[model samples]
Target: MIEVKEIEKKYGRKKILKGVSFTANKGEITCLIGLNGVGKTTILNAIMALTPINKGQILIDGEPLKEKTFEKITFIPDAITMLPQMKIAEAMEFMKDFYTCWNQDRATELLGFFRLNKDDRISSLSKGNTAKVNLLLGLALDVDYVLMDEPFSGIDMFSREEIANVFTSHLIENRGVIITTHEIGDIEHLIDKVVLIDNGLVTKEFNAEEARENEGKSVIDVMREVYIG
Candidate 1:
């Protein structure tokens, strides 16, 4: 489980995140949703320690996240820079050496699912395929927490569906996934909880089952009301 308590961050005079608090429990997928620039990515960065917060604590399983927590967390951002000169197979081999949790069989299966050729140069793959590889790497890492920022940003509909399904089925049930995405439809069925941020604050949090039972609305409908209404 991951608990973010009263996180606050600022860039000059503009406050990006203010007193944010949320929990992502194991065996559940919690989605962060909101309009662009509403601090969704900032929250993920803060949790990953990629961006230092001015205030508050980020805890993993009741313990505050420190430098040693890197092994427990895997982050996949919207834009990732790989050695564009390397081949797909070479990149996988490099990551396997770097992370103790790297799963070779899972990586191979993901490559096949995405129709990615191992010998293809990283720079030669299309934009969507590039994102697929990024996603593949994160999913294959055996970690407790996976934070994905805009994982569905540029993919086609069919690939997006396939990716979502694979993520759901392959994810370790004992771990947690916190994903930030504008494409709510892609994860509507997969997510267990929704945490919507707006104006730099957590404006909404709902469980899929509770929301459906109490509000009689789908996740897409709730999202429209939260960010668009």
Candidate 2:
């Protein structure tokens, strides 16, 4: 499990995350839902230690965040991390050389799953294909947790559907996943927990199933109450 307690962050004088807190458990998908610039990505960055925090604690399976702990958690940012000029195969080799946990078989499988060609240049691929490559790079890693920032953003409908299919597939099973996105419809059924954020604060956290079966609410319904009402 990953626990984030009272995290605070600022960029110069502008506050990004103000008292953000949440927990992501193993074998479940925890989603951070909010509008753009509400610090959703900042919260994920804090969890990965990619961005410095002003105040807070982040724990992974009861241990404080550290270099070794990072090995067990994979973070895929929204932007393309790989060099634009690099080919897909070269990017695979780069990941293999850097991370001890890199799995060649899994990478190969995802390459086929995403219908991506090894010889294809990252810069030459379409926007949707580029997103798939980004996703494949992260999902191929052998890790206990995955943190994704806007995996569904800026993609075509078919690409979005393909990516969402991955959630139900064995690729993501039994691994704790924390995804931040404002587009909730595509993944509404796959997520186990939803943490709603607004104005740099976590406004609500609840189990998705309980919200439907017990409270009779869909994710969008809850969103309307939180953001609209």
Candidate 3:
């Protein structure tokens, strides 16, 4: 499991995360849901160690995050990370050289699943295609945990549907996932847990099935109570 304890982060003097805490268990999809600019992405960044935190710690299976630990956890950021000048095939090679966990067969499978051509230049792909490429890069890694930031943001309907389908496929089975997004409807049925955040604070955490079976509330209903009520 990934454990985040009292995580605090700041930019200059402005604080972003204020004592945030949560756990993403293995074999489940844990979602961080909140409005824009509420430090959802910041939390994911802190987990990946892409951003420095002022106080607190993140642990994977009771161990502090390190270079070797990254092999087990993969993060897909909100924006494209690859150089636009590179072709899809070159991007694959770049990942191959960097991470020992890169799986070429999985990459090839995702390329077919996303209908992406290796000859296509990253700069020439549509917004949705670029998103697919980003997803492919992460999904191809043979990791236990996958952290994603807004994988469904600013894409077309078909692309959104396709990406959602991937969540239910065997590709992600048995792997833990932490995804931060305001677009919860797409994966509401697929998520196992929900962590609601607001104004840099983690307000609630609960099992999705329990919320429905015991309380008769869906994720949207819980979101309304946290963000609206």
**RMSD of candidates 1 onward, in order:** 1.8, 1.0, 0.9
**TM-score of candidate 1 relative to the true fold:** 0.93
Error of 3 at 96 (Å): 1.3
Residue-by-residue lDDT tens digits, candidate 2, 1-229: 9999999999999888899888999999999999999999888888888888999899999988888876799999887789999999999999999888899999999988888999999999999999999998898889999999999999999998899989999999999999999879878999999999998899999999999999899989998998889
Off by over 4 Å in 1: 224-229
Q: Which stretches of candidate 2 lie over 4 Å from their true place?
A: none
Off by over 4 Å in 3: none
- 1-229: candidate 1 lDDT, tens digit per residue: 8999999999998899999999999778899988889999999988888889999999998887776686788888887547888888888998899888888988898888889999988899887888888887787788888899988887787777767776667554667899998668656878899998889999889998788999899987887787678
Q: Give the 10-residue window scoring lowest on summed lDDT in candidate 2.
A: 62-71
Residue 2, candidate 2: C-alpha displacement in angstroms = 0.8
lDDT accuracy of residue 151 in candidate 1: 81
Worst lDDT 10-window in candidate 3:
180-189
- For candidate 3, lDDT tens digit of each residue in 1-229? 9999999988888888899999999889999998899999999989988888999999998998999987899999977889999999999999999999999999999999999999999999999999999999999999999999998999999999999988999779999999998868878899999999988899999999999999999999988887777
Candidate 2 clashes between residue pairs 3 or more apart in a chain or in different chains:
none
lDDT of each: 0.85, 0.91, 0.93
TM-score of each: 0.93, 0.97, 0.97
